[model samples]
Target: MKRRKFIGLLGGAAASWPLAARAQQTRMPAIGFLRSSSSAPSQFLATALREGLKEQGFVEGQNVQIEYRYAEDEKERLRNLATDLLARPLAVIVADTIAAIQIKAAATTVPLIFASGGDPVAAGLVTSLNRPGGNVTGVVFFATLLGAKRLELLRRAVPNAAMIGVLTSRTSPNVEAERGDIEAAALALGQQLTVVDVNGEDEFDTAFVTFIRSGARALLIGSGTLLTTNRARIIALAARHALPAVYPHREGALDGGMMSYGASVADAYRQAGIYAGRILKGEKAADLPVMRSSKFEFVLNLRTTKALGIDIPPTLLALTDEVIE
Candidate 1:
């Protein structure tokens, strides 16, 4: 009887071993991924980040866990969402530019990594890019700085468009600076520009109307989370209005916009993921220098050009990095 009892006890212990191992796996380090835009539109960016993490040997679900939260273009919800993320037992927090600002404002002590489109110093996220000097560091793609380049590309595509319309977001932190850049570029190119600001999606129709009434012949979509989140709608509107438009990211061209000139947003997110992995591997966020995105893409859509009946200048076509049919 005693031998039978010992055998049963050993069997019971063996049966519980797998559950113990699973419980330990469940306790693996988790990363908090916060974005200020909608998830569906930015899924590719998330995948890019995961790819970066994988490069650092931190595959999600197998070794590390990633908790993703998106505010869906609602800026007001960012802080609360960030706070909720903070409530989790996370190893690191990775956020987009706007979401980083809100999370920093909440005074989080977690290791924070940001994928920013604007200047990190100007946004008060870091003291300097080289040495962040705090629990914050990530990537800066400088998308806002490419406004003039986008304007130039649009002008090249629509050489006869004298009155160019600009659609800018009023709520973006870098709005005024981007507007100033576009205006200065337009002035230098000897082009008349009509600038219209939209605060929400409801105002898009009105803004388009204002642009048309102002005799604007082309459109320059400004850089911001708001504009990027609603890119499809804006592209549809541009097509409906028969406006030759230039966008700030390649995703815009891929989605049927006329053209786009900007740094790779996916690469920036991937770099941010690398930073997160580094931090997870015992590197300090403050010690990691901010990475500047070096990959820029000039994408043009032939379908959009045909729809708008614009002839692509051969010189511009030669300079394009990617052409969509």
Candidate 2:
């Protein structure tokens, strides 16, 4: 009887040992990265995001894990992607302003951090900028609000342009605001503006043809993931049309667009990453105030200018933060 009792006690202890050991192994937190752009263009943004996480004492694959879901510019896939990310036991979700909407609708408990080009307050993602007051808080670049400024630069680059073609993505929620701002700006500048709506990548060539037929001397590319993802083709179209154009972000100029003026997208992503790390470290999402993107840059590509036979204005070139010869 004593021997049997000892064996039973030893077996129970052995089973409990493995359970204790498994409990001791902490599961690492995961960050779900949801975007509407492709991975190829997102390399720099991803690196910047990682750098931000490093700043918060979190390293990918070490203390934290990042699950990336790129929709490759297909807006239709965003809701499904958000649902899939929600299925995972994610510690937090970091996304673009547009994607943030979908994620917000899918998960109510999981915290959301975003890097958006639109106004979060206007989009109803947050109650206010100073106090987000919800499970979502991150950075806003306000790229759509800079339409007038970009048009001004395009006008400066092509002084004689009376009519400018504005390419906008109709599917984006921010389109109406962008159009209103751009139209007001164009009227203020005394330049005729033709707004062309592009719904997908396939409509790009047709939009360019429409712009050409409308007799536009210059073009203003709108802000959105769809436009940014297909930047190379749009820039090519602009070059083929011999149209001097201005883009929203530096990536466009770096990718061979004529000129760009907007917030640094990579920096915004880095900020989002930093916020995500903080949230994972026990900081409440509502307590963290929304951050506005302040790092705007003006980039000019002289090579594209020369190729299109458009002379860069001395004043505009002087204002350029970066000039690609």
Candidate 3:
């Protein structure tokens, strides 16, 4: 009887070992997604992020978990959201726009991946592009630097416009840099530039009125998640004021803006996601080289141009990657 009992106990222990090991192996690591904009306009970007992680063998709710937090375009709310994400069991933090700054400040031990439209190095998110040399690394869209290019595109679309109005987000970290680049470009093109700094949706109407009163003939929208979140209103205001406008993303052109030229925002998010997955897979954030967006697309809306009574030049139209009828 004693011998039989000993053999039974040994078998039970052997069976439990594999069960415990399996449980430990299957434990899901949580990834936190922190964004400065609302989730409504970011759904497509979220899907792109998921696809990137899948490429790295991290499937949400399968081998990994995701914690999502959004600031809803309220800059004041970002810190709170970041703190909330930090409180969770996060193995890596995937952030975008201004949230990168907040996350970088809060979580030093946790790896951070960001999709920043601004200059990441200038914003102090990383040490350098080639060697990030810290806990933060991801894709930089160089959206602020593209201000000059976007201005040139607008000028081409409205060559006769003597003055152009720039709608800028005061809360954006890259606002000053973008404004400076746009100003330089405008001066080089021999055009007068009027800039209006706005922080919220409530200020759009007043800013548009001011631009119109200033005799600004065309509009140039700056790059920021907040501005993109409120894109429909900006496009509508431009149409109502009879202002030809250039935007920073293809979606803006699809939403009735006159023209757009910049890096693909969705692709940037996907790269960020890929970096997050790599970090979760035991790769150090400091080891990952910072990535720049490889895809840039120019888009034009023919219907918007027709409604504004402006004829798009064949040269500009030919340069567009996509045209919305």
- Number of backbone-clashing residue pairs for each candidate, in the order shown: 0, 0, 0
Using lDDT as the measure, name the better of candidate 1 and candidate 2: 1
Regions more than 4 Å wrong, model 2: 1-16, 19-24
Local accuracy of candidate 2 as per-residue lDDT tens digits, 230-320: 8888988998889889999898999899999999888898998899889988998999999998778999999998998888868888998
Tens-digit lDDT track of model 1 for 1-325: 9999999999999999999999976787999999888888889889999999988999999889999999987867887799898888888998888898888887557999998888889999999999998899989888889888888888888888879999998867788888999898878878899999888778999999999999999999988888888899999999999998998888999999999998888888888888888988999998999999888999999999998899998999999999998
Model 3 agreement with the true structure over 54-138: per-residue lDDT tens digits:
9899898888898888898776788899988888878998888688898888788888998888988899999899999878888
Which of candidates 1 and 2 is the stronger one according to TM-score? 2
lDDT of 3: 0.89
Winning candidate number (TM-score): 2
lDDT of 1 at 91: 87
Candidate 3: give the clashing pairs.
none
Pairs clashing within candidate 1: none
**What C-alpha lDDT do the candidate models reach, one value each?**
0.89, 0.88, 0.89
TM-score of 2: 0.93
